[model samples]
Target: MKEADRCCGSAGSFSIIHHDLSMKVLERKISNIVTAKAEVVATSCPTCTMQLSYGLKSHGLTGQVMHPVQLLAKSY
Candidate 1:
């Protein structure tokens, strides 16, 4: 595949109302994605994609983030 499919911890309103909890969940997702050695992250939701990009940068990961459709378009 292009990248690992992991939740960005932006559980709709959860992230907006619960910052700490969202960060915690995002940390876990980031850890898993890092362990997987993903070169990039592709997500469907705009909010989730943005949150994942932030998480990657915050965790010092060098992985790029994009939407699944974007990846597909690039591949073709």
Candidate 2:
């Protein structure tokens, strides 16, 4: 897994209060995803997942960002 797959900038309410820093962190996370060559990025927290998905979209990455459970349910 890449560093991006293991990171999130939406540290709860901190994301909303610290928009600039959060965005900067999100950017780094997206880069990590590309470096990792991940097809899907799953996260447990909805806020963090949103950051992941939005970051991917903004960065023009086609990788999927979803909750682990959502991915598992889709598989079955």
Candidate 3:
């Protein structure tokens, strides 16, 4: 499997309007991804991507973040 998968945390205006709930959801996602031992994470949605990146950084995870297209481009 690829090193990372997209994080789904109700990204979009929902995140902005419900910061605490969004973060709670994101934290759970981060835990799962980290447990999977992924080295990188890529997402299609900008907001989801950024939020996941922030969560990873805040948790002191040593992982890289990239867009799905960016990751594909690099593989080529």
Candidate 4:
């Protein structure tokens, strides 16, 4: 989990300019998620939120992807 805070390659224009590279970076993140056996993935950024969701589906993971705000709102 050393690189847990590393980029997931959804850096706005960076992703658009480096589509292939972005996916490659995201793939690594997806692998980490799978390795951790996580049941859910949440984030504050809308872009990363989508990235994790797409990553989970693409990697055949059934984990849920959501925003922390959404969870908080649900708890209210």
Pick the lDDT winner: 2
The RMSD (Cα, Å) of candidate 2 is 1.7
lDDT-based ranking = 2, 4, 1, 3
lDDT of 2 by residue, 1-76 (tens): 6564454789888889999999988888887788889889888888987888889888888999888899999999
Across residues 1-76, which tens digit of lDDT does each residue of candidate 1 receive? 3234655679788898999989988888888787778887777788888788899988788898888889999999
Provide the TM-score for each candidate, comma-separated: 0.84, 0.84, 0.81, 0.84
Q: In candidate 4, what are the lDDT values of residues 1-76, reduced to their tens digit? A: 4366888888777778998999999998888887888787778888888877888888888998778888788779
Off by over 4 Å in 4: 73-76
After TM-score superposition, the amount by which residue 52's alpha carbon in candidate 2 deviates from its true location, in angstroms, is 0.8
Q: Write the per-residue lDDT of candidate 3 for residues 1-76, one digit (tens) a residue.
A: 2223534566688888988888888878888778888888777778877888888899999887788789999999
Q: After superposition, how far is residue 10 of candidate 2 from its true place, in Å?
A: 0.8
lDDT of every model, 2 decimals: 0.81, 0.84, 0.78, 0.82
Query: Which portions of model 2 show Cα errors greater than 4 Å?
Result: 4-6
Q: What is the alpha-carbon lDDT for the whole of candidate 3?
A: 0.78
Better of 1 and 3 by lDDT: 1
* lDDT of model 2 at position 63: 93
Superposed Cα deviation of residue 14, candidate 4 (Å): 1.6
Q: How large is the C-alpha RMSD of every model relative to the true structure?
A: 2.8, 1.7, 3.1, 1.8
What lDDT, from 0 to 1, does candidate 4 have? 0.82
